[model samples]
Target chain A: MTTNKTVRLAQRPKGPVKPEDFDIREEDLADPGEGEIRVRNAFVSLDPAMRGWMNEGKSYVPPVGIGDVMRGFAAGQVEASRHPGFKEGDTVTGLLGVQNYAISDGKGVSLADTSLAPLQTWVGGLGMPGLTAYFGLLKVAEAKEGDTVVVSAASGAVGQVVGQIANIIGCRSVGIAGGPEKCDFIKSEFGFDAAVDYKAGNLFGDLKTACPDGIDVDFENVGGDIFDTVLAQMNPFGRIAVCGLISMYNATELPPGPKNLRNVLVMRLRMQGFIVFDFIKHNQEAMTALGGWYKDGKLKFKEDIRDGGVEAFPAVLSELYTGGNFGKLILKL
Target chain B: MTTNKTVRLAQRPKGPVKPEDFDIREEDLADPGEGEIRVRNAFVSLDPAMRGWMNEGKSYVPPVGIGDVMRGFAAGQVEASRHPGFKEGDTVTGLLGVQNYAISDGKGVSLADTSLAPLQTWVGGLGMPGLTAYFGLLKVAEAKEGDTVVVSAASGAVGQVVGQIANIIGCRSVGIAGGPEKCDFIKSEFGFDAAVDYKAGNLFGDLKTACPDGIDVDFENVGGDIFDTVLAQMNPFGRIAVCGLISMYNATELPPGPKNLRNVLVMRLRMQGFIVFDFIKHNQEAMTALGGWYKDGKLKFKEDIRDGGVEAFPAVLSELYTGGNFGKLILKL
Candidate 1:
């Protein structure tokens, strides 16, 4: 008999989630069912989007039901497999929950290789965030050379990739991040043309300097006044890919508007919001392109990994909302 | 020599234009020169777009300079002609200004059949506003059948035509107007599938009932909260054509945002701001189709004409911003 530690949703938090929202308990492991694989969680990705899953509403993905395991996609080593395709010792990735072990029936499960990149990179840079940056910027935003692309949350998992990809496409990439260090990271390491320190008192000034020619494409990840400032500076026919609204995720009320939204008309701009799951058809193309970028050394991948086992889930999850991590917030057990 | 009453810009007002900002005076008309025609102005068009022309900045047309004739388009009779294309007694249209008489070089002027639709109709339904509504909604929005369309200022010139054209294309049309009467006009006169009374309050509730399936196309003329409401109700892949921002035109301060704009991504919606002048390439196609619709009685036209001469220009211009008139607001000079 084997025991596995799993985290359960104790209670749904009204706003920003706390440790009380989760319950860690040990469960007796049962035999794997047909076409099922048992995996010990290695790295669990912490995303701002997790805030939405805790809410009960209609969205791109299903809500995390009360008393169910806290839903999260994780990458790990397979402990046991009764599946025909996957075998023991094979590394895999899937929605493994906040558990040390998971049973997935072939669907939504994927194989991972550290040879391509680091194992954690499979969950961050080259995973959902990278794919999101690739498809959303190229396919949805339709970014082009000589175009000025502005991105928010510039040092985060998705934003870092988005700015780098914009640079790769011969665009003038401008990133808006929390502090000077993150801004420096995008400009120096990611090869972004410019970076704006949004935390500085002079946001409008920094934005103006960072985006001298005006923004042609804005990959919005942080919503609030940042969106408003970007609204005013957009050139004609600018495209904004609505990626995430991280700033307002914990709020119990509707966020204040960007006060200058009507600028969308005078500038002849296209501001569209999107979720990457909608581009399921482009998954292959995304992986191929991103994988190539990773190989060519044109892209920079960074991760802040915390290792403390399953009991660390609550503390780790909150760090994402607080923006405690410099890059992709991931946990390795 | 024929004497004519002319209204010229006396001074540029700081905010809401005042009557003192205009100067009405008599001007002596010169005889027609070669390639120039003398026109007796009959109807002068009053438009919200004129406010944009008052400010010294980049715009669709140059600002009306001080001491110059208050720049405006009008329908008039060609009293004397030296141009080969125009003849005496012919009804002509041009940038005839706010004067009762003018001399034209016959350059950039459109000839109209006054019998088909009155002079005011040429300004409203058959002229700029009409052409604006036709091109903005059809060419810019790319409105298609089965798509749900919502129009702000539903009983006004552009909104009325946009809603009816949506209906003509076999799409569901929902109108947002100021009152019950205008809402009724949108349905009874313009054949909009449904009408929302914005002044009645509960705009979101009314919008939900009117657009049960959600909005695919939004012909935006008014900005502010109304824009926010429509954005919340837009469906995935929706398109928004920004024609004007009447609601924000008279705003002395910054216009507050329509927050929830991030929904543009959640729904994969496209919110675009455009000026009809950008769609010059599609002019021939637009004219041919709209002309056919008008002649076949498939489309309806409306005009709000104030029976006032050049002296009434100041008062009539205020009516547009105040939402005091339905359809296109024009003045008979």
Candidate 2:
């Protein structure tokens, strides 16, 4: 008999996530039932959106219920399969939960081609984060050639992909990251047009310097002061794609909105909020474009894969909010 | 020799318009030049945007310069003309300043068809305010059949027309006003489906009760707390046309933005700011529709024409920021 190790939600978080909010347990593993497939999850993806999913109340998606396996996206090889579509030894990825083993009926499961990249890559750039950037920048913001695109949280998974895609589409991509190190990495490694180090305490001026002609498209990930500064610099008829507000995710109380929101009126700007799940119908088109870019050397992804198995889930997940993770955060079971 | 009584901007207003801020004086009026036409103005329009124009910063339009004729829109007959486009007794309306007489070269001038409505109505509903409501509701917000459209400052010039137009287009129109009298007037006089009295001290609950299926479109005229409540009640894929922020215009300092702005993302809402000038190309189409509705008795306009000349401009204009006017506040010269 084998044992499956899993992390379950114990309670709702108050502010920042704490380890006591989750329960790590081991249970007896069962074989695949009728039309079911068993995946031994190799890598579980960590996202800022996970923090929102743990809260109580209505959100883009339902909250992670207490005592249930924590909701997450994972990539792994199938150990057993009773379904005809997926067979043993097949690599797949989906919302398979934060567990050593996941059972699925193949509803949202997608086959991962390992010849293109590793399992961690499948759960990183080529996965939800990559697709988020693809749809948000192209479809929502409608960033065009010769446009100046700005993105916040530039070193994170989705932000990095967004900047790269903007450059590929002939836009001047300016990234906003926390420290000098991450800022330098985005410009040097990711080939971004410019990087504004937000930790330098000159956000408004630095952003103005980076975007001389004013911002045409903004893929806003971080909310609060960062968003306010971007709002002030937006050109007439600019588009803002509100993909995430990670800065407000863990707030115990609701914070005041951007003071420069008046810019939305005076500048005739269009601001729309969107989730990657909202664009599920266009997944195939997005994946084809993203995968093509990845294969042609136009795209690259960095993974911060950690050890200590599923037991390190809480600690590794908390690193994302603290800016401790340098790239696409993932846990190797 | 005729005399022209004009109101010139003495200095930039700090919080609200004061009588001392304007230098109302009479000067010897000159005859029409080679291409200029002199208009004997009868009615001047008052708008919330005028307050923004009084500041010393950038806005949709340049600030009204100190010692210059205070910028305004007015309707009158051409008393004398040397321009080919104009003849004597021709009724017109344009950005003709706040004075008893105006000189124009026929640029941006729109001929008023008094046969359709009165001169006050031209500046009130058939002029900028009407076009604003037309483009803001249909073009900017895209309010269609079955949409629950909400507008703030319900009894004001643009807001009344917005509600009436929504009803004409087969939408459920809801208006937000301050007092009970204004709220009841919107529903009974302007034919709004419902009215939410913001001064009733139960804005959130009242708005929820009025919008049973959730708000689908919001024509935001008043920003601040009223905007925050409507934002919270918005349904998925809702559209918000930010036509005006009357509540914030007279604010002495920058106020915190809507606390519930996060709803824009969670509900996948689209909030766009627009000015009537941005849609000038579509003016003919909008006017044809609005005029047809007005002629068919399906559209109604309420003008609070104050019996005051250009000298009363400062006091009458102050009434707008305080919500003292019951309807479209226009000054009769």
Candidate 3:
């Protein structure tokens, strides 16, 4: 009998998560059933979407129930398999949980290389975050060459790729980061045309200076005041691709509304929000293009990995809400 | 010398317009300048946009100045012309003011015929309101077939035509009118799939029932509570054509905000607004298509004409703001 260490939900969180809300417990596992494989976990993904999964609502997916293992995307080495395609020591990624071991019935399970890019990198720029940036920016936003594009959370996993991809497409990309350090990283390190530090106390003024021709497309990761300010500055017929609303994810009450909604009328702007999972069918084409870009040195990746077992679930998940993670947030067991 | 009676802007109103705000005056006739033509006013358009024309701002056009004739669109006869294209007794439509006689530079002019449709019908479906409905619904919303489309102010000038066009394009068209009379008019006269009275309470609930398939395209002319309610009922990737905000145009203060803006995040909806004046270049092709539809009997047109002299300006303009006009609002001088 194998004992599995799993991070289980002990209590529902009120606002930001507390350590006591999770309990890392050891549980005995049964033998793998027919057509099922038993895998030992190597890495688990921590993302901003996990915050929505923790709460009960009508979102893209169902919420994680109390007493259940924390829901996550994980990669692991196959220890045993009764399925046709599986073999011993094969590495795979799937919607596994925050645990040392998991059983899968071959649905959405795919083999991955831990050598080309770290297992954590796949959780970020090479994986979900990468595809999210690619499809949302190019397809949803319909970004074209010579367009002036703006992205929020510039140094984060998705924002980093969005700006770089815009650059590759011959567009001028402006990024919105939180501080001077991240702003410098996007401009110098990530090759963004310009980066705005929102916390610098002159958001609109700085944004005005950075975007001289007016924003043609805005990849909106931050909502609330930032959204309102950007709405006022958008050019006529501009498009907004809203991938996340991290600014209002943990709000106890609804944030005050966009008062300058008249600008939406005057400028004729198109603002759209999307969940990345909807692009699952475009996986092969998306990854192939991203992989080609990576190999050609046209794309870059970043991973903010936390080394710990299932015990770090609560803390790692909270880091996304608090903006503690610089890139894709991941935990390795 | 013949005297021309006209309605002039005596003062700008603070909130709702009053009778004293207009001056009934008689002015001497002036000959048309070079390349200009003189038109004797037959019909003057009364629109909610006139409210914005009273204020000094950078909109689609200049504001109506104090002591000037209230700026508007009108259809009349070319009693005299200094231009080659126009001649004496030719029926024409141009941006003539609320007056018995006006001179135009022939900068903008259209020939109107009652045999093609009624004189009022041209103003509503074949004219400005028609172009507003046609371009805003098709070009701005990018509305497609099999989409579920909903429109606010359903019995008004723009809303009625938007629903009819959505229906003709294989979309399920739903309308939000003010009363049972208008609701019936939207369903029976306009051939809309369904109608809802938002003022009957439970605005959001009514929208939900009216559009069970979920709203794919929302033509937003009345903002405030209607916009708040529509935001919640949108389907994933829904498109909103934000045309006007007649509800809040006269309000002294900003109305209370929407409650569920986070829906913009969860559903990935798009909202945009525009003015028809910006699309003058598309006039030839647009009117040709509209004329084809009209000739095929695939579309219907309606107008509500209130006849009087310059004394009718205050009463006619007031009807537009109060949901009192059944189709298009027009003042025949």
Scored by DockQ, the top model is: 2
Once fitted onto the true fold, the runs of candidate 2 whose alpha carbons sit more than 4 angstroms away are A1-44, A54-56, A64-71, A74-120, A305-325, A331-333, B1-43, B65-70, B75-119, B306-325, B331-333
Whichever of 1 and 2 has more TM-score, that candidate is 2
- The TM-scores of all predictions, comma-separated, are 0.78, 0.81, 0.76
lDDT by residue (tens digit), candidate 3, B89-174: 88776678889988888766776655555565555577777788889889988899999998998887788889988988899999
Clash-forming residue pairs, model 3: A273-B268
lDDT (tens digit, per residue) of candidate 2 on A1-333: 458999999999988899999999999878889999999999998988898899998877889999999998899999999999899999988889999999899777888777777778888898899989999999999999999999998888899999999999999999999999999999988999999998899999999999999999999998999998999899999999999887786678889998888889999999999998888767657877887888888899887889988999999999988989977888998
Native interface contact recovery, model 3: 0.61
Error of 3 at A227 (Å): 1.3
Q: What tens-digit string does per-residue lDDT give for candidate 2 at B1-333?
A: 679999999999878889999999999988889999999999999987888788898788889999999988899999999999889999988889999999998887777777777778778888788999999999989999999999998888889999999999999999999899989988998899999999999999999999999999999998999999999999999999999887776688878998888888899999999998898767657766877788788889877899879989999999988878866789999
Q: Write candidate 3's Cα lDDT for A1-333 as tens digits.
A: 889998888887877899988888999988789999998988888877776787876786788989999888888889999988788788777678889999888676666655555556556676777878998898888999999999998888889999999998999999999989989988888899999999999999999999999999999888778877787788877888888887887688877667667767877777777777777667657766776677678888677889877887887788878778866788988
Reference-based lDDT, residue A160, model 3 = 95
Cα interface RMSD of each candidate: 1.7, 0.7, 1.9
Candidate 1: stretches off by over 4 Å: A1-44, A66-70, A74-119, A306-315, A322-324, A331-333, B1-46, B59-123, B135-142, B304-326, B329-333
Q: Compose the digit string of candidate 1's lDDT tens values, residues B88-108.
A: 999877678889999999865
Per TM-score, what order, best first? 2, 1, 3
The residue pairs found clashing in candidate 2 are: none
Docking class of 1: medium
TM-score: which candidate is best? Answer: 2
Candidate 3: what's its TM-score on chain B? Answer: 0.86
Q: Fraction of native contacts in model 2?
A: 0.83
Error of 3 at A59 (Å): 0.7
